[model samples]
Target: MLFLTRDLFSKKLTILFLIILGTYGCKTKTSSEQTAEQAPALVKSPEFNADSAYQFVQKQVDFGPRVPNTAPHKACGNYLVSTLKKYGFSVVEQTFKDTTFDGTIINGRNIIGSFNTANAKRILLTSHWDSRPFSDQDSLVKNKPVMGANDGASGVGILLEIARVLSLQATKPDIGVDIIFFDVEDWGATEQDTSMLHSGFCLGSQYWAANKHIPNYTAYFGVLLDMVGAKGATFLKEGYSMQMAEDVVREVWTTASRIGYNNYFIDERGGSITDDHVPVNTVAHIPMIDIIHTKNSVVRTFFDQWHTADDTMEHIDPKTLKAVGQTLVQVLYQESANLAL
Candidate 1:
């Protein structure tokens, strides 16, 4: 995803006004801080297993960079499909063809996994799975592909672990959960090219938002994860998210703070990003927020190794995964129990 600069923001397509809904209401409660007022029938959400999530990240890295149309990409896609199936999710592989900024026709697949499909109220979780074909940001290997351990695999790993845990749980979430892995997201023009900035990026999400796998699919709200497994990560409230779904962002960040993850989920506003969530919000009309690592550093808005060959397993931290994964689980379970917004 590209950071939204002043120029880009000015040139951005107008986002449709989102009709926000209020449905959940609950005071924050941690494992050790449950009061009588908050203790009544609230279900304690399961602890996220960081180690398992790390292994899932490692497994994807072992397949090398998952650049779309490559052998490794195909193999990894199959593995993801099988893993979701093993977790008992109703899977949908929506395939499409699109031309890249360089005029290369790429075969893309947006993978969807649905849990508790019978329920009308659903929550959406998503992340891009395909790695960039070229490391344009890396001066050393500009032509090489990025490993994307934290950028691509980390979010998917967390969602995979969530699926595994939900499958084993006797009491399922009252609301349905839909996990989507968007492909061909990073096959876009370099940062220097301002003209192709927004139009070239997020191809997969644009397709999925326009042509959903299920007819007339909708979610209560959605969360998109990116660059979530680095050590000492900080997730600022994204600009578009604040504009489209401020209440959902408040709920998620507030939940993170209650669960001792305040250090990661910062309370500052971040620059608007042209990511998968944008299309989901604008085209599909589903309010979705991006939980991505951003910083006020001089070097970069994202992680140190973003879009570089150094984005490997060495940079991934299990603690960060646990923070994000556990917070998501808590939010899901809280919604499942019919808590008021």
Candidate 2:
């Protein structure tokens, strides 16, 4: 009877050990599974359609040089307003007149659009729409107006496509977004013409900065796109942008690098430009940066076709457009992930 009791005790002890072991194994497996479930998923930005952007540019170029106060300019302005509305944005047409460098009064319109109206934290994007009146830099055809396919229309086209993608997204970004197509930016006085009023450039932005679409409007940051569609374009950081909004510029350049666009967005300092972002930064008090394609050195010639009649569709590369557009989309959408819940 003593021997039988010993065997029974041994069986009981073995069963208890097995139960404890099973419980521990199950707990370890559960802990690993829980950890995986808690891991954060990577954020995904919407795809930017380079073809659509290219087509939008073509449409604007088809309207001829959009010089302010001309028939083509008026028609293009109307189209921009309509397109923004169609993309589910609250469009605002800011109309104002400003004197050009040559002392000519020109009618200008700034087309502004907004997305995610409920969100108070906003980001501003901008580009010029009006073409230069004369291709003064062109050795041949100095009397003709600039086509502005890359200088003006390219930025607008990319923004329009971005707006379209935003509208079609399944999940809207948590931050408010605004796009402004500022006119009269290219009407600045030439360097040689010292007698002309140099401040006459970027008139549309100057007007909007003083009289914003919303009273006392503000954005967390603003990005200005200029000369972004040139073939083999290299977008070095502008000097003013780096000085005023270094963090923003770093964020953009890093994002571009992350997305295999390090070639287009070089990690170098570029010459400061008096683009529309200048008024937005100084007058509106927003930290604005210009993502412009400028020469590496102080020469800052901008591009081969800059201010020339050769600034046409032939100079635009779909790859260049995609690089800028994709990087922009990634930055904007990733910003959503950074917002407070």
Per-structure clash totals for the candidates: 6, 0
lDDT (tens digit, per residue) of candidate 1 on 2-35: 6888876765533311212122214445443553
lDDT of 1 at 232: 92
Q: What TM-score, over all chains together, does every model reach?
A: 0.87, 0.86
User: What are the Cα lDDT values of the candidates?
Assistant: 0.90, 0.89
Candidate 2 global TM-score: 0.86
Per-residue alpha-carbon lDDT of candidate 2 for residues 95-211, written as tens digits (9 for 90 to 100)? 998888788898899999999888999999999999999988988988799999999999999999999999999898889999999999988876645564335688999899999
Q: Candidate 1: what lDDT? A: 0.90
Off by over 4 Å in 2: 1-42, 192-199, 297-300
**Number of residue pairs clashing in candidate 2, backbone atoms closer than 3 angstroms, sequence gap of 3 or more or interchain:** 0
Clash pairs of candidate 1?
Answer: 23-341, 24-340, 24-341, 25-339, 25-340, 25-341
**Candidate 2 residue pairs in clash (backbone atoms < 3 Å):** none
What local lDDT does model 1 show for residue 283? Answer: 91
